[model samples]
Target: MRHPSPSSWAVISICIVAIVHLALGFSFGFSVDEAHYALYAQHLAWSYFDHPPLVGWIQWPLIALTTSEGVIRLIPEALWLISVSLVYRITLELHDVIQGRSSGYLTNVLPSGPSCGLMATLAVIAAPLPHVLSIGLLPDTLLTPLSLGLMLMALRWLRKERFSLGDWIITGVLLGLAGLSKYTAVFTVVALLMVFLSAKRKPWINQPGFWLAGIIACVLISPVFYWNWVNDWISFKYQIAHGAGGTWALRRVAAFIGIQIACFGPLMVVGVYFFLKQGWRNHRLTLLALLSFFFVPFTIFAALSGGGSLPHWTTPAWFCLAPFIGIGLAKAWSQQRRRLISSLFIVQIALCLIGFGFVLAGGPPSANLKANPMADLYGWQSAGQKAAELAHANNATGIAVQNWTLGSRAAWYAQPLPVYVLDQRQDQFDLWFGQLPLGANVILLNWSGLSYVPPTGKGAGFESCRLLDSLETRRFGQLLSTFDFSLCTNWRGADLVR
Candidate 1:
């Protein structure tokens, strides 16, 4: 029996790296955003106000099988890992083709690449993964492959010219599913347009394959249209208002760019640039197709959009750039420079341990970072228990939360007690349980921080409000967050009372 070579070892190591990701999920609590997404599972639907219904639908089964946050997280993390694994697989096939397999049954079956698989595999491992990405249930997590697939599949179809109609349909389905995962995927059409419009490929725009794929994609994404039409197109309008505007916060735009650079790794600056040059130098039109996916989103959402928001909104495009980084670094550097890349990977693994270890413990060890942001995940179980106890003590008929985040936590922890979120923000909680009856006593949890201004909705919106006990969530002698658990008497409409 032969031992695994260094090349194969990288692929094998991915499995171990994946296990580390799964194990860490158990340590953190649901992110503020996660509770909201997880709560989406409670009220199943065809669509949602913030996004398409795919995320809710995806989370529903996993959320049902077990409430364990770690287990719930494993679903999307598995998808992300699968995407990486696919890229690694693609590199292997590409490598075989490039390295001189004149003709063989297996050789013909595999995809070939200009670079070896090891560099691509290692670069993906070294890339920074945000806490929310690793722990939370997010649509972007689901969007990973569809976006990458759209680029990779389209590139292969254009460059190789050996693909059949089935391959074209698969590309369409991936593009459609990408749209289902996130609105950003809509730009894939525009990218493909650039591919068709390319000087070399312009004549092929009249091809039936193009129209065939377009129709299939349209069919797959039609549900989004159906849902929005039923709900007066709120989803469409909401995305526009939420992501785009003339607020003109240059600092926000700058920060977004900086965060992306940090997330991709500073070394990627060299990797991505050289990769692009090589791709253009070799496969010009094919490289442009891959690039359009990255450039269009990054330009629109990060460079142009205003407001300080999630830098990860640009993640899918950045993710598509990974294989390039791997190949770029492989070619640009000498064998000795491998030490630097290895050192970076070691740092990443160390950070995963040290950082998550601190966060899992609910605090940092004598660090200036002060409180751990991951602690937000820490307090939900305790907060839910306290809310449940207070609801029982008040003889409250039901629970009402001021915001969706608190409402989701309440729903998860305070089960069997119908929890209603009476906020202006239109979430499923508000949609499903908006019917809070009149003359019913309700237990309201108002965030102390959000209380800086006058409380509205189920908070100050109540006719008779009595102060109950404030619940303090602490970990390791540090006060994480404080919640005002109030007993509001009489049923005054949250909007009406205010």
Candidate 2:
């Protein structure tokens, strides 16, 4: 048998990398967000109160086939496979072209470059954030492709001043699709536009095709806002609530940064290192422009918006710096530091795996529970299951949770038990549930509203059967640490003694 060359091995490695990504879903249970997205996909609305509808829309087809957690998650996992493939293709193209352009070497494919491509692809795959998130269906998965597609298209257009009619249409459609995936993707377009206009070396901003694409994207994405307007812009209000300190404190921001570092892994380290190392050089300007225009605006927006910021909000910024990191890594490997670089890659991947396990264990080792964040991953599923069990035990018609994010997850886990909210906010929990007749079949409550012994000294009309305590605990920096959730049952809750 003929032995495979290094090039052949790299190709096989890339395939293995893709498989590893797909295999990851099996290890993790569904998170609250995953459960929410899975349940929400069933409805197929034009838009949702919290997010645009694309994630739900994308996952709907798979979900129609099976409610299996792994099956529903596979859709995004497939997308991630495609994403890794795209990175491989993109990196190879850049390497071949850059080699010819900079060094006047006409090489068909660099043996070393594919390894670099694999590294970048693996960086994305094993980053711990997208990998974990991709394991659960969410808009971010859909956004990943759309966002990268937009960047790829922009790079192509930047390389070539003249945009063909086909390029214009495809770019426009993808940008609009990306926006549909997540509203945050709008910032991506801003970054792309800046790249085009500021390309003084090869300016293409004055072209009608460019503006045409921009207009088409706007026209396509406008319907989301129009739908929001028709619904009193609840989505807008939700965004505002999320952005404007609804859950603000100094500690959350710091935690967000720390999570991001873990999420991006070695890739983030190289990207940050490159920025500082190559500051203000001509080649670095592209990255600097991208960082300044996109990350700066988005960061300020996130800090100010304050409703409830998640670390993923800053994911796009890290993306802008990835290509630069790729270039830096290539330089490092070429300069005979391959062993050192390889060691770092191995170490980074190991840390990420350890962290991923920590999350899956339901809490971190540092925490009191020693359960990893991944444990919280399925607490909602468990909570919902518990609700169903109680309903089955009591021979009740249904069981419901107090109004919160858990309502959807619990109702979803509870299945045949319809999940209902008394009202949007907490103060009305009693008013809403109290209105229900005495001897209510089942009601589930979370840590906050359930544990409350009202100042007026009334229980929320639910007798506690169990706390459904979180086996996992998560600390989002020092600002806020959320207990996963527990089910508090009210067998014969109360009267609307108002």
Candidate 3:
């Protein structure tokens, strides 16, 4: 078969990757974090106790457009475009390292340069997590682009051996943006430091640009720390508590590693080896990639210390290593089995489609604890709907839901009714609800657990609130079970309670 030009192959890779992700974005509902972030966006604040504010800020516009699932997903879909472009650029850059720009007929080394790009992009885009996770309004979408941007800039800085003040500013800005998107992004700084400190060429640490970049990153992340201080360090406590839940069973750790391999693909093994091979000779650049991997230790420490670490925490590790790995794969495959490389790309695309289809069909991914049997323990979307119906029957002017996943989804399905989120964590309900006039009909989707029965005394302030309906794990999907259960309200003057 005839070979295509390097540039042509890169284009083909990007198109396939972008198209696959675009489709995946349309197929799935917002995962839990996506829903949470979307709601968080609905009301802008400096930051959430659990995460930085970038996700909410990024998603704010999309949430305003339409409540439609597809509209909210557009942000993630858009990121895929940027991701693909960066992949192509990185691949081309990596190729140039070994096959210097002036080398004649570059075709001799990476004869199928464009095909190589195609393989790399497909490998990434075809992966289920990247596509599925990206589409939802989450931090990853924001982080992915910024991480890639930083990498590109880092490469340029590394190659030039001298970065201007502007270059440092741009690098710091991108890193800061990435940090806001996800805390794991702090690893990028570590990676850069390791590279600069170790690089034999120009000893990058002494340069002013390096310090400028560091200061910029610090400034960008200042808001997150500021919020933490104001909240009495509750965010830190919550994160620590959350991380403690995962036990340090060796099997679990092994399983988590296994999950990453399956999600990221076996090519990662090759990627690792490629780095090790290059690190042996090209020590400086290889160490930069290794530093990214060092983030896994941070994650493990978080897990072991009972600190929170999500599955995607290592995303930057894989992403930063992409360029070096791509070059290695290109070199090795060009000599050994170039034909199979395209086949691998095709398989990834196919897997992406199947994975998305399965999720849409109710075959939930591992990330969605909500889809597990424990969902009722969290909140039932269907139950929320039933609660809404009772509110309608009671002629309630507005229903007060706790304004979480269950509350929000209920509000979403039961539209047109004024729903107030008693976000007690923030003190809104406590401040205004007591002083404000009561609505004719009022229903409170309280979260103090089902045991807290409503007051039945004559002065209980409801003519009579009754248990209209209740929903639980056993009767999850059937709304009928929850429709009739309710806690009767106590009315001041009415004798209904008697």
Candidate 4:
């Protein structure tokens, strides 16, 4: 036999990593967020109550394929390839820029040139926070790549110091796509604007590319804006409240920083080392560009810490960080400290394996509490199926649940069950399905608890709402959760309950 070339090994590595992620996706049950997004797949919309339509749009085709929790996760995980490709292109471009045309091809002959891009790819998928959380169907899954693409385009425009109308349009389109994925993408536009107005780049703004990118981006996102207007800006308002969940605390800001540390881990160490030793002062434009590109996403999420925000709001920043890490590792190759980068890979992989260990060991410490904040993913598939059988048996005209998560989860797991959310919040379902007919029979899954019963009073959307049966989601014969069931003999209601 023959030894595989480095290129052969690279292809093999990508396949192996891809297979592992697919296995991991299957290993866990649907997260509450996954369940919610899976619900989004059911009803096509211009925009949703809680988010823009792209996540759902991504899942729309998959609806025909399968709804199994693990399979649903693939919608985002498959996108990992795109993320890596963008990173590689950008890294390769940056490498060429820094080294110059004279040295570019000569360096490409060496192993490190190509491998830097691969390293960046691995850094992203291997990182624990984004890697694990990204598996579940989520907006960040799409947003991260679009964010990187937006940055890459902006970088290209600036690196050349030329307007290139084509570059601006592509940048605008990518920015639009990113916004569709997540509003945090607005930061990319801010970054571009900041760059356009900077001292060296100021003249570039007078060109059509400057204003056209903004206009095209706005035109691209017009659907969401129009949707917001029609829906009373519910998505924007929801995001505002959600981003700032509580009063500001300096500790949260600190915690957000700490999360980046944990998420980036040893790579963060290498990044700091590169900056300190390499002294980025020489690459001021590149550094300024990198910082500005990162500032929008990081600041948007980080600033909200005063109100309340999670550290991962800076998830796309990881996309930005990867190329920097890649460039650092590439430089290390010349100095023979390349082993440091290899060691970081081992540590990151080990950390992810440990995370997988915890996830696979599903039962939480106490069933009385939300287990690992992921308990919803477990035990609910079977319950949802059973609820569907019960609803069908009772001749239910509609299956109603009290909240979005349960409603979405139940709808997916319970095939043929047209689940309606009967909560104060109006999600995609209400907009499409509208009110259940007056005097219609309903099987209400009492989300409150086992002992609860719905109001039987006239015009409370029920002629009579009585507890029918209760199902206990148990683990090893211990009750994890108990949900009361109600059979509303004749639901009388139109429009949402206030």
Candidate 5:
């Protein structure tokens, strides 16, 4: 039998991955982030407190039409596939740049353009974090492809002496869309600037099209500024405090590095080594562009890891490096390292399967329900429904959670009823539901995973409170979490009742 071409293999890989993502989406409940972003759809706004509005705007139509978690997930799955295709396109661009080079070593090492593109696509699929993004939509999900598009445009511009009007417009629109996707996209703008300033010819600096691109991007991102202006810049303040809030710790930095290797897979690590070895000599400009995109945000996040940072914040940076990594891996395949490359792919596949198994099983039974990380994703659906029912039974005006993290799931699963966070911190929930009015009744939900006590004394927020129901959530006959619903009346705010 004849073997499939590299392009054919890429298509097959994408199809298979899509099917897997769809299955996972159907099998699991909405994750904490997923539910939070989905709630953004229900309440359409210029922007959100934690993120820009594109994530919610993209799903608004689907949310209006249906509430199925699986269907909502289709959006992210499609975005993931788009990101994969963009990576393939970027690999091809890299191949063309390398092929145009005079260096014999660079020319001899990399496989054909099609083969390089295939390897890059495969690298994205094998990565663990991309799979998670595919299963659930987040701000990063939308930003991934937009960031890749900006990188591709940068490469195309590098091929020419000057950028045309159309090129400038396209670049601006992509940058704008990226800004609308997430705040992290500012790194993309910085990367683009680095590429322009580092270029052999810098005449684009004096060009009219360049200024036009700036105006267009600013116009497109005006909503973020507009929303912040009206809201007293609360979102900006919150993000600043959030990212820089934690104390510095060496262990956090180490954990961050470990997560990058684990999520991106071991093969990409080898690929990075190869790129560093030959990239400077063979493709200096290309190396600079790719590295700027990858390292700018990556270095910031790594430094922030000592203070605090989420692993997924660097996803766009990892994606920006995919094309180069693809080329490196393709070279490895060309050399006699096929077995080693294959083993890495096998390990990645095994890790993906294990991750899915853990989700399906709703966390290990041996673990404490409160301590199980998977417990966050397992019990929200049941708990939300119980909260809603209890609220109705007790004639409560709304549902309350002690933390903002818990409000999203409750708000989403409970539907039109308002969900409020009883905590002191102001967040999206506070903006949406406002302070639960003084002397109002509410159904308080406390999950074993993130339990909190409802205050009921003379100095407490509530006048009186009693347990309404306890919901037990299980998967494969193993209890994953329990949620306690309490009916509390006459909330006098979180102050002494005089």
Candidate 6:
């Protein structure tokens, strides 16, 4: 029997992955970030407090048509598919470039470009975080494809002696889109510059195309700049303080490295080692160019990990290295290391499935609701519905959450009725529904995991409060969390803390 073509295999892999993501999307409730970003669409703006507008802009149309969680999730799923395809194309391009420069035992033994592309695409599928991103749209999901597109265009531009006008324009547009996607896109822009500068044949600095690309990128990202300007640059100030605010610790750095390895999966981790070893030996310039993409963001984030950076912040960097890792995996396959490859895939796939199950099961049942990390993804939908009903029955004007984190789901799940964060913190919620108005009756939602005591009396925000309902969230008959809904009347308003 003849084997399937590499392109055919890639299609099959993408389809299978999409089906799984679709199921997972339907199975889970909105994650804290997912709900938060989804709320972005409901309240349209140039940009948001914590992220740019692209994540919201991309979903605006679909959300207008329907608010189904699974349907809304299709946007990210489509973006993930595009990212996978781009990685394949990038691997093929890099493989061809490297092959042209060499002739010997290594070149002869290496798998074909198409095969390498397939392997790289599979490497992405084997990873866990990408799947989570697929289940819900995040800024990183948007950046992944935009970043890959910039890398591919950069590689093509580097291959030629003179830069093409079209390539420059495309790069500029992608950079702008990437900027709209996430602030981390600046790393991609820097990486592209490093690629051009580090190459043996330097790109002409005075070229009109280069300047045009810069202009285009600036034009595209003008909204973000304008928004920041209007908001007194609060977003920029917050990010700088957030990224570097934590105290440095040795264990934090070690934990960050461990998380990266686990998130990338053992197969891709090994692939990275092989990629660096082989690229440095044969294609030093190419290696440096690629490293520019990975190392800058990875190193900065790793260092900031000591300052409490999130794990997914390094995802785009890992994605930049995907093509080279694919090459490494392809070479291993050519050497008939089938057992090793099969074992790694099995382990990763199993882990991915187990993760999905954990989410589906609403995390492990525990007496302490805060101990279950997955509790966030479990009770929000039901709580939102319960809050809405209670508000209607009691003639409450809106729903109020003590923490900003709880506002997204309450606002999203209980639409048309505004959800307010009672806290004084300046967040996206503040930008949306501001503080609950004076003398307004509101249903205050309190989740056991992050519960807050309702303020009452003459000096407090409310005059008096009474328990409206208590909701117990369960999965397979196992209790996961409890949400308390309190009816609070006569808001007096408190002093703004920030």
Q: Using lDDT as the measure, which candidate wins?
A: 5
lDDT of all the models against the reference?
A: 0.67, 0.59, 0.58, 0.69, 0.86, 0.85
Return the top candidate by TM-score.
5
Q: Which ten residues in a row have the lowest lDDT in candidate 5?
A: 101-110
Q: How many backbone clashes does candidate 3 have?
A: 24
Cα RMSD, each candidate: 4.5, 6.3, 6.8, 4.5, 2.2, 2.4
Ranking by lDDT: 5, 6, 4, 1, 2, 3
Write candidate 4's Cα lDDT for 247-279 as tens digits. 888888888777777886767457536633665
- lDDT by residue for model 1 (254-295), tens: 777777776766666656764555433333544565567778
Output the better candidate (1/6) by lDDT. Answer: 6
Please give the range of 10 consecutive residues that has the lowest summed lDDT in model 1: 103-112
lDDT digits (tens) for residues 1-498 of candidate 2: 198743465467657655665666665556667877776677677777778878888778877887777677678777766665666655555554445554244433333566556555655644666666556667767776676677677657645647797898899899888888887776777777776665576645676776788888888788788878887787878676666766567666666656667767765576346435534333444445444533654577557544456666655555444544565565555658678667767877787677655554545546432223343554455556656775676665465544445565665667756664533342212322234444454444453213333111155454544444342223344111233333334434334212
Candidate 5 off by > 4 Å: 101-109, 279-282, 496-498
Ranking by TM-score: 5, 6, 1, 4, 2, 3
Can you write out model 5's per-residue Cα lDDT over 331-430, one digit (the tens) per residue? Answer: 8788787998889999998998888888878877798888788878877877888888888888899998888788889998897889988867778998
Backbone clash count for every predicted candidate, in the order shown: 7, 20, 24, 1, 0, 0
Better of 1 and 2 by lDDT: 1
Q: Candidate 2 or 3, higher lDDT?
A: 2
What's model 1's lDDT at 466? Answer: 71
Q: After superposition, how far is residue 244 of candidate 4 from its true place, in Å?
A: 2.4
- Error in Å for residue 474 of model 3: 17
TM-scores across all candidates? Answer: 0.86, 0.77, 0.74, 0.82, 0.96, 0.94
Error of 5 at 220 (Å): 0.8
**Higher-scoring candidate on TM-score, 4 or 6:** 6
